[model samples]
Target: MSISARRHTRMATVAIAGAAAVALALTGCAGPAEKPADGEPVEITFQSWVPNIDRAVDAFNAAHDDIHVTLETITAGPDGGYATMLSAVQAGNPADVVQLGYDAIPDFLINDALEDITPYVSDAKDLFVPWQWQTGVFGDKVYAIPQASGPLGQFYRADIFEELGIDYPKTWDEFYEAAKVIRASDPDRYIAAFAFNQAPWMIGLAQQGGANWFVPENDSWKVSIDGPETAQVAEFWQKLIDEDLVKIEADFSSEWNADIQNGDVVTWISGSWADAILRGTAPETSGKWAVGAMPQWKAGENVSATWAGGSANAVLKGSKHPEQAAEFAVWLNSHTDSVSILTEIGAGWPSIVDTAAIASLQDAPEVFEFYGGQDIWDVFAESDKAVDTSWSWPPLSSTLFASLTDNVKAAVDAGTPLVDAYAKTQADMVAALTERGISVD
Candidate 1:
């Protein structure tokens, strides 16, 4: 398939010259120009959005005498700073290793910018969960290593649940009942904060049944946005908002932060990344929070799972030191000490599953003190097992999300019928994907 007209247009604006200028200004220098001697230290540029990743690189540098990683902060933007890295790649000055979102891999694959890491996977592949290893594969080739896995779960205020005398919900129906009880206890305080404006929630819901909305069928991919399972989940959330059981927030911003800190929002559906947010944003509420398995369809439905979001390290194809870069990527992702450093600083969950780092985390005297002594690692580990490998974000997901935000707000705020709103979203997604040359039929 040809590159989408819109994507092509964007690429044209970032011509080689324009990209070179941007790269020089932003990165200061192109990646290490010459290969270092066997005994001489080798330095490679490592770019990522996570702030604590530098500590991991530092640990790697300290441990290894041959290779040293120079950490670069990739600024976060609407696309999570992917556009900047894409421009760098176009200019033939990409970083040695870059952290990429799972959804962003297809575009890199089509552009031939990502280095196939199949060669390195043989030794380290078994160290990670099966789904983690599968996350970077496309057409039998692996382009990246999974840095972290996000298994969705319910992070709730244990104090609020105790105050309301409600038991932790084990099923969806019970979950709803718990929400109602929390709401009844106080009209002003909501049982949960549903950021209906965010696309992650929709993606999480679709993955709840381990169903992929866009699946390969014969020669083309088929989209099932209005599938019975997804539609039910959407309608339920819609009702939650309409009935005032849940508060609709715009996004994770200042107001949302206040709500969480002040206990205006009692429950939130989030992945492992949320642990950092809870600890950082509401230190006073430490030990007041507890995580539970994601509410499943029934007691024993398919493994309880949802979407996973985290960055992976990949070597760009044009790098001068592909071998060194590939080795750096492997060391950064697979080494237990590096993973432990990243997790200790609260960047995100470690990508390598079943590492001693996990046990070390469990032993931290203060780890669960933030969650009222709840064993968060155990909760997250159980949730990790439930992650569905089939769940993925569409290539043109950003554009589709822009369309859904406006229409979903209209439905939630103006009392529009849920079915009508969903129908409109489906049509908009089809149109958007069609314009991008992605088959939605």
Candidate 2:
């Protein structure tokens, strides 16, 4: 597959007029009423890091004549773009709607930057999956609506697996055995790959059985880093690294891409959104890749679930047009037409409960081809169904990840005692949380 050939499916852009026309046609009689308030055209600002925001804003502007949205693109860099949002909100000019990741919600809520949409949720709560809808909740109030979700899975080079005469592994034991086989066959090549310097994989492992590092206890946060389940998961990964069965990279970068394309790394354990990165980076490897369920804990560990990594849309407290913004968010997340538009633009799978969107995605041959003929939608849907809704994070999730990653590297690379390293990480987390007046008991 050439680079040009591997590009996303080119679909005609739906004009604003076309969207209005379609909305009118769906309503059966006439278009929606004119602007309720004839005041200045309410310009709602939307903030996000994804490139698909442009398309969403365009569709939104075309569908409604009353409110115009101005999208502000934030770079998804090392800072995670939270600093930008924080500064803006502190300056009393925050965006009307912001795309908040699961881990970032708690911090935003703590700062009172998010609005409690519990009232609005009752209007369209039935339209989304329960877990998706609940991801943004801080207490009894909904703060965000799930816009997209990416359940963890194993992305592998199918062609390489076929060449080695091996099947995709279904369990962790089998996965490790397969890794050993790949290592023995070609000492320089690895069956699975990851950036050990990152905590994303660990988060996936912890969520394998609905386990989380933090849990709510009497309105205070409690740590579970040393739980039996977490220890077991850590030991499993540590053993794999020690045995040289998996390739450990420093980070996700161009060098990692080179390793993947050159067959030095044949598989990756990550969320479904990784498909976009894979397809974009290794276009020549397009029909050779496939996706499968994340290797489970033992055999039937709580139905093989993992944590999801995606963003949710929320209306900020400062928005003047809260009602309209809330309505737009519901439409973006639940309406089939909006979801189709998002899919066509290569955003991601919608969080809506509408099975028709899943069906339509499954039937798209271009998407399947990009995934090495794998029924990726089926894999995602299955993972979505089995997702562990208990997974959550604190507002300082980025800091926590940095601390844990540093500790893990110290133990794995510097030969430090794992227990001591984890203790240091726990202390660091406690201090950070304490500084914010959050209890880490």
Candidate 3:
């Protein structure tokens, strides 16, 4: 494919088809690279943050005599990588391939930063989980290859629950009752932490309750940060906060780490990727912790959601070799050699549809032994299948996250109802999108 075929003359079709007039063009508009001389490998660059990912890249280079990919390590997105990638895009120089979170795909599309690689990678769609594949598709165009997923699950201190004679709650109502029991047992401990500062965590909770914060309608976005389902989720947590049944703490912080290590916090409702985080942060609590499916909205129901941990690999807009880059990306995430490496290194759950084929995942005794010898992958597999395929992300997700975090933190410090934060964010989001010339209803 030529560079122009990959480049977008304007913003992506999905987010700005008829909303307003917006223009974005690659400055150089150079022609595609000439065919490589015989026996000369095609050289391309890949930007990513996954730990130990170079093992997979090295394997790719060794297996393919026609292509060689150079890996460039960068800070994780939201910690300067996204800014760096955008700066490179605007400067007419960017890596051939870049890693992006699922929620951030729409943002990249809106900025015209991703290449349309459907011509080269469309056939590989069947290799990944259905919903995960959809994350890279918009308006019949495939912009990326699904790399990994983060289906929701619950991580809890099993020893503490057993000591208190409490079983894992199966439903939200039962979870609330269990919270009361845990709170009554000791004032220093709570069933969980509010973590109001983490917008992605709250978004997953709302999604589990069947909330769609953003919807595409008539080529415009229907913003609904204050939808009823989201309000219900907010109100439920607000009750827990009002009654002092949950602690107010920022997750992954020193205070939160202490709580986890000391058993002051009993459970965490988060993505499957949190397994690595929990083990790395609180190694002392290895056998005491276990994983389970998220508490359902109703008894006997099975539904789940994903967090921001899931990511995809996209060919950047101005790549000189889009076809080779796309081919390398597809193989990096799907080939047995690469998938095994990713599994062993704990790169989020592999996005492959048939995860059972990965030898590392099939017999992870060490992972099982860490969580009291229970097979935690079974829980994650079930959670991954239960995720709602109808859910989607929206453009300007950074703004959405920022607005929600600011409002929720203000509500927490002011002793006001938490649902009020969502209400305020709804108005803030609509106005912000409108000011950017993007239609919002």
Candidate 4:
């Protein structure tokens, strides 16, 4: 019935001056939202980027006579929605509920943008995965409801690996050897692309290698983007770049799309959700692709990580109906109807405790057929279990991504070692956090 000591310590650091300002704003600007009149449903707005999620909202509205939710579709957070939401928060009006990536929870918490929904949703805590549920909790307060997850995995061109006599890599060392073989076999083909432009993918790799880039420490953050475990990941990828064993390319670009279609880029080390992207990008290459668990750091290790795709629904600070909003968030994610719709739409893997009970997940024939008849969901389920629960995202994530991307791009352009970018990022993060009046340990 009590919060863990680790979480107690972590959340203590989130109550900064920004949080104080938000608390004052909430108390001074608005009182508790009043209940609706007799026979009138409480109306609330929900903002999200997940395609076809509106259908789930419709289902909720039809099923619940007490609450009616309006779905306001927006661009994915990284593209623009985060700024839009923050602006609304600053202006003293925001949607009743909004979708946010797991990593963004800390930033929202530090800014006090989210409402404490603990009193409303704590009873349903056992319905979802524990680690994911924790993503929404700061100290002892729950600010969000877990909806989806992004367990890391490998999506590869199975035909190419077979043709080159290379088995699916099970370890990082074996992956390097496979990279060498793929390059030596065909000048144009490589094992995977070095996606320096994508910060989340790079961070996921470091996480898989036991890197905790950010740690909560005594009411401050211990910044360690250049730690030893991260160094191992950087050096491994840098070796691939130096040897020309992998293509240096930005993902989802015209060039990268062409490579994926033509089999030049043989593998994509991304989240389980990538299967849908690959299917949409290259429908002509069906049955050529397959899925595998992320290659381990050592021969038998089982560490995994979450990509940026996992998201949660949080009630904003200024909502007039936080109680109804929290109820809708919980029902929409846990109910079979909503979870099935989410699965059909290729929303990231659901965070429900009983994934097996979801029929859509158990028998997705079309999805299996696309990936060479392999049940890719099985791989993701295992990867989800292997993920380290200790990994935590820091505040100022937007700054973190921009700094890492710019520094890494500069390094690549200057022909400097890619590992140097992490060190540079270390300095950039500390400066930015200090300027914002956040303590760095």
Candidate 5:
């Protein structure tokens, strides 16, 4: 939570412990392991934001009498409870297992606040999507259990395209063409809006072979948030704004919601979880929406990239019930029944490769009802496959999001060009990382 400048030793230093020591830490340190007495159970506290976590925890408690998990819901914070979780950890009274975003793992790990759970789920490596699995890992140790994945997908109005005689656009060029045609039809209506406040959209675009700001060095990190490919993305959007082809509006505001409901905003580029959002916000437009793939660089390419909103379950190292915590985390994330329940209830997209969970979503009448009876789960599932798994997030992802959002808003308001915003974001990112004793090559 504190970003004060401090002088330290090597910035990129990560101490790798032996597997035996890691196992001991996961089992409550080198002391004698505590076992529940004849009737007593090893209790572990789980802090989470998911509303349906009780369903899973109750099932777990009923099935296993030895390890009981008590669920606690924490109020959501602006930074997604990052600062609150750190404060708890610093106070030496952290929850045994906590809900965590994959992007924030590096920050917690850098502070040595998470427990290495590799010893418990070592053989469960092939249970999740390969890319989602990578989010839980730091160095050679696994610090978290992946619960959900967010792959980008585009949701558009089916009726609008039908009315305008425009088929779905496959390539960026056709998308641009569609934008021009649709926006010119009405003064108040536009194809879509490029919201400057949300940096996840920009991150998703950058992952589409446009640019990658962070690269892995030997033990350090290379910070380069600006490049020719990223500039290509910015320049394309800039042209759209310059020609008035797209609306530059604030995201998630009352105005934006009104635009969507009023048919002023037709197409939405976001992750799989957005299906729930569209259904919840504009029930008036029910059956008018349909899901599809995002526009790619090439006409035939099917590639897409991820945006915001994915979290993992991790155990804290200082907990007394580390083994029970690890077991509970693994079961909560990897169990087939739990996965099915979570996905069926619209708890984001499940990262686990549970066939039953996937089957529950595919062609299910309920999953397609909001999208005019179209099988949207299939579209999102395909997008998941097309995500670029090689992309990496910086350790200071929270700071990166804040800085990028501000820079992008400046670009939108002043028309000084998004490339300049990218430059400032890069410099700020470099300075912020270096100030935290992090190596930025």
Candidate 6:
């Protein structure tokens, strides 16, 4: 294998740089890493979106003398970081390790941007929670180590539910009714936002019932974005929107934040990671919020789904220190102390199950303070177990999401019909994939 040409000095930690500048800094292909002269360390550059994760790097630096990691933060995740990383890789300046979303793994693979870490991490497979760990495996080649996992749930205002003489809806039918009840109390209030812009959210809901929107055949890929289960999920949400029972808002916008703060959006269909976001956004709503099991297809059904999110550390193909990067990625995610620090910083649920990391999260009063000190981890932990394991992200996930977001969002904005948009999404997805020379079913 040809080594990357870029190399960094010992203990090199650069502040987040512009894409071109960072690419220039990381550009090079050196043969297998050579120990620095005068007993200097080998430096590994990491690009990620998680804040305060530097504590883990510091911990690793303190424990290991030969290897040092430097973390780089991106301005916008899932969109900006993925693009910049691709630019860096194409420019031959890729970081030694990059934090990538589980959904984005196939894109990186499609570009051949990740190094196969199977030789290093295949043995440690048993250490991580099974499904979370499997996110990095494609074509039986391990590309990365799981750093976090987020199981889906319905986060809602408990105080409001109590004031209105209602309980958390256990089924979508009940949720629709609860939405009416909530809306009836104050005509301006809404139960939740059915964001057509949120493709992952739609995909997650469909995944709850074993949606098979994506499939693969031989070396090519196939997509069925309008699969039956997905259509059912979409039709349900569409009814809520059509009835004006749910709000429609672009996420992370100021208006959305205002709705959340003012309780205009009383319920949020989100994942475990949103817990931290909720607390950070609505500190005044402290003790008023709670997480419940996801709304199911039928009442009294014990079921849930995983929104395709979370990130992992991958040894980039351009790295000259694949072995060192692989080892560091594994240790950063698996070492008990390191994982605890990550969990402490609210890095979502631990990828490694039943570890002190999860135990600490479950036991932390502050972690659950937003939920009136309830053990919401138990909700997410169980949800994680019940997730639809039949689903796997398609290699063209970005295209599929873009197709759904654009076409479906148009329908939502135009007041046409959401279910009808699914057909367009499927057609657009198939067309997009076909342009990429990927087979579409």
The number of the candidate with the highest TM-score is: 4
TM-score of each: 0.86, 0.85, 0.92, 0.94, 0.88, 0.90
Q: Which 10-residue window in model 3 sums to the lowest lDDT?
A: 2-11
Q: Tell me how many residue pairs clash in candidate 2.
A: 2
| Cα-based lDDT at residue 287, candidate 2 | 88
lDDT of 6 at 183: 86
Superposed Cα deviation of residue 50, candidate 1 (Å): 1.2
The 0-to-1 C-alpha lDDT of every candidate, in the order given, reads 0.68, 0.68, 0.83, 0.84, 0.76, 0.75
Shift in Å, residue 35, candidate 2? 10
The reply for model 3, stretches above 4 Å from the true place, is 1-14, 18-20, 24-31, 34-40
Which has the better TM-score: candidate 2, or candidate 3?
A: 3
**What tens digits encode model 1's per-residue C-alpha lDDT throughout 75-151?**
75346566777677777777878887665655555445676667756577777665555556654556687777667
Candidates arranged by TM-score, highest first: 4, 3, 6, 5, 1, 2
* Residue clash pairs of candidate 1: 287-370, 287-371, 287-372
Instruction: Give the per-residue lDDT digits (tens) of candidate 4, residues 1-441.
Output: 333337534654543553553443332123479688899999999999887888899999999999999999898755588878877877777888999998887777776678889999989899998878888877677889999889899999999899888989999999999999999987898899888789999889999999888777677778899999999999998899888999999999999999999999999988877777888899999999999999988888898998963889999888889999999999989998899888777678898898777887889888899889999888998999998777777777888888998898888879898779999999999997777667788
Candidate 6 residue-wise lDDT, 1-441, digit = tens: 101001010001111111123232333333466566678778889887887788988899899988888888875445688888877777877889988878887667666678888887778888987767767775456787988876898888998999999977888889989999998989889999877778878878888866767654433445666778777887888888878898888877888898999888998888777877888888898999889999888767787776675778888877878888998998988898888778767677688865754446647777688788788878987887787655656555677777778887899879887778888987877676566555444
- Residues 174-267 of candidate 2: C-alpha lDDT, one tens digit per residue: 8888888888877679886646676766667767844667765544567776666767777777778778887777646777889788777888
| Regions of candidate 6 where Cα sits further than 4 Å from its true position | 1-30, 76-78, 217-222, 356-359
* Candidate 3 structure quality by residue, lDDT tens digits, 357-417: 7887888776777799998888988888888766667777788888898999999999998
Output the better candidate (1/4) by lDDT: 4
Clashing pairs in 5: none
lDDT of 5 by residue, 173-239 (tens): 8989999989988898788899887888888887775576776655567777888888888888888
Instruction: Provide the lowest-lDDT 10-residue window in model 6.
Output: 4-13
lDDT comparison, 4 vs 5, better candidate: 4
Q: Which lDDT value does model 5 have at 425?
A: 95
Model 1: lowest-lDDT 10 consecutive positions: 1-10
Point out where model 2 deviates above 4 Å.
1-40, 119-121, 300-302, 305-309, 344-348, 358-360, 417-421
